[model samples]
Target: MNETMRPVLGVSVAIWRGGRVLLVRRGREPFKDHWSLPGGRVEWGESLQDAVRREAAEETGLSLHTPHLVDTLDMIGAGEPPASHFVIVVFTADATGEPVAGDDAAEIGWFEPEAIAALPTTPDLARIVALSQRS
Candidate 1:
């Protein structure tokens, strides 16, 4: 397939503790400096659950389990000409231990659903957070 025709696969994890969800500030683009779920691209030969586990550990320093599929996000780039396309698999998982930001995260925090609206985030983050909370 052509480069533009190939859809990149990625995973994002929604980790909840108490009544708040974990979020990481992206240290890279396409949504640099924005608060978003902890995840990254799915490497070749990796299962979706494995990708979610790996990404969550890399970004948030937490071990996650039982990643249940929550949603799928289509991120179509916008520019003079469309630049990229990503099909992100979103998951909700249970986690333990305090989080420390690493990898592609600039910072990390837990926020209530109501508070998420006030922060800048990737598209549909608030909705994803809400959906994950219900799962």
Candidate 2:
């Protein structure tokens, strides 16, 4: 079977610093050029917490800590035709550092809620960020 035929499990972090959150412009597909949270797939034998931290480090070079589960999303019908399905576990963590984009991120920046509202982003991204803040 093609890899896309299977469900993909991934982890994303809402790395918040004060009233702002970190977002990265994707360099790859599924949401290329769209601003989204910093995260990626969870490897085998890794805990959710570790996966969240590692993904943040790889994509944004930030050291995330105390990540707590916020929500899980079934994004099976997201994006354009031939869209890939992702069941992503979202976590919230606090980090402090000057983020430098790497991995699949094309660029990185910190944005307030109002700023994020104006960007092209993954479905439910704003909602996820809101939920992460409240949790």
Question: Best candidate, lDDT-wise?
Answer: 1
Reference-based lDDT, each prediction: 0.92, 0.88
Deviating ranges (above 4 Å) for candidate 1: 1-4
lDDT tens digits, residue span 1-135, model 2: 354487788999988776898899999987899999998998999998999999999999888869889999977764545367889999988886779999999999989977888899988999999998843
Q: What's the CA error at residue 78 for candidate 1, in Å? A: 0.3
Looking at candidate 1, the ten consecutive residues that score lowest on lDDT are 1-10
Candidate with top TM-score is 1
TM-score, predicted candidate 2 vs. hidden true structure: 0.89
lDDT of 2 at 25: 97
- Give candidate 2's whole-model lDDT: 0.88
How big is the positional error of residue 89 in model 2, measured in Å on the Cα after superposition?
0.2
User: What's the distance in Å from true for residue 58, model 1?
Assistant: 0.3
